[model samples]
Target: MPILSRAALVEHLVRTRIAGDVATPRDNNLSHYRKLANGDRHYWLGLELGDRWTDEQDVLAVMAERCGVIDDPAHRTGQDTIDPELTVDGLERMAARLRKAAAGQERVLFATGHPGALIDVHSRVAAALRAQGCDIVRIPGGLVADEGYVVQFADVAVFERGASLWHTHSPEPMNAILDGLGEDGRPDLVIADHGWAGVLAQPVQDRVHGLRGVG
Candidate 1:
C-alpha cells in the first residue's frame, strides 16, 4: 500500500473514527474523567497525579485541552470529539520520538491496551525500528492474575508485524514486563497507550511515551 499524503491521512483518520468525533461515547469519556478526578487508581492506571487534580472541573479542562473533548460539564451525552488537529499534532510528536530512537538505535518496547484498534500501527513502527537496528525487547511469560482472570504476557507482545493481544485495560501486564526487565536490561524507550502506557509513564516518566486512543 502506498503511504498517504498528509491530507489523505487526516481524512482517513476522520473517516475511520480515529480522529474528529471519536467512537468513544461522550458518557464513557465523562465517566472516565470523573474517575480520574476522583483519583481512582484503576482509572489512573498507575499515574501519580498531583493534588491539583482533585477538582473534576480541572480534570475536564485538562482533557478538553489535551484530548479535544467537550469542556462543558453540562454536556454529558453524545459522541465525544477528538480534534483532528490534536491527532495530527500527536502523530508528529510520535514521529519525532521514533526518529530520535532510530537515530540512537534505542532499545524499545511497544504495547497497547486497545490492541484491536492499534496493533497494526504499533507493529509497523516496531518493524521499522527493527529495520533501523533498534532492539525490540520481548519478555515472555509475565502473567497477571486478577479476580480469577489471568492475562498472559504473550498476549501483549509487540512483534515485528502483528500483536496477539486484544482488549486489555489492566496495568498488570506492564508491571510484569517492567519487573521482568531486572538484570537483562531496561528498554530505553517504551511506546504504549492506555493502561499499559499510563503505568509505564509512572516509573520511567522520561523514557516512556503514551499515545491516546491506542490504549
Candidate 2:
C-alpha cells in the first residue's frame, strides 16, 4: 500500500470526527476504537498498526468525536452513554512491538511526562525485557518532571502512553524531553508517541536513528 500524504490523512480524521463515527477519549487511552456497539456492550477494534490510521491520522479525531462535549442543553441526552472499544491483547501487541524494536540495545529507558506513580506498567515491561536479554530502565524515584530528559539519552529511549497531549497540540513537554538529551550527541534511537514524532521529525533524524511509533 502506498503511503498517504499527511494532509490527506488529516482530512480523513476530520471527516470521521464530523460523522460521529470516531472512538472516544477513554477508548483512545485503551488504544482501540469500537468495532461494533451493541446496546451496552462494545466489541473492540483490534489494535493493529493498520487500525491505528485512516490514511495518516492517528486516533485523535475519534477521541474528539467521542469525548468532546458540547454545552448546548438541547443536545443533551441524560441516558446516553459513550461506549468505545478496547482490548487488552491489542495493547500487549503494541507493547511487544516496542519491546522488539528496542531489543539488543545497551539500555532501554521508558520515559513519560506524566507522574511516575501512574506507570506501574513499566515494571512489567522491564521484567519482560530482562527475560529477553534487554536492560530496561525507568526514570528513577518517580520524580518525572525533571529527570525525563536524562532518561531519553540512554541507548534507547521511549515515551509510553502519550495520546491526549499529542492530539491537543501540545509540544512543550515533548520538546523538553528531546532537547534535554543533548541534540549534539544524542542516543541511538528515540521512540516516542505519535504526536511527538510528528513535530520533532528533524531533531529525531539528526540526533537518533529516527523516530519510532509514528503510526
Worst 10 residues of 1 by lDDT: 154-163
lDDT (Cα, tens digit) per residue for candidate 2, span 1-215: 68656455445545655322443333333323223222111222111122324421223345435443322323323322222222223344566666554565434445333323323455455555657775554333222332232233232233333322112222334454544544433433333433333344544345343434332
Tens-place lDDT digits, model 1, residues 74-129: 99899789887788888889889889989999888777777667767777888899
Clashes of each: 0, 0
What candidate 1 gets wrong by more than 4 Å, as runs, is 1-3, 142-166, 203-215
**In model 2, where do residues sit more than 4 Å from their true spots?**
1-61, 64-85, 102-107, 137-170, 183-215
TM-score of each candidate structure, all chains considered together: 0.80, 0.37
The TM-score, computed over Cα atoms with residue i paired to residue i, of candidate 1 is: 0.80
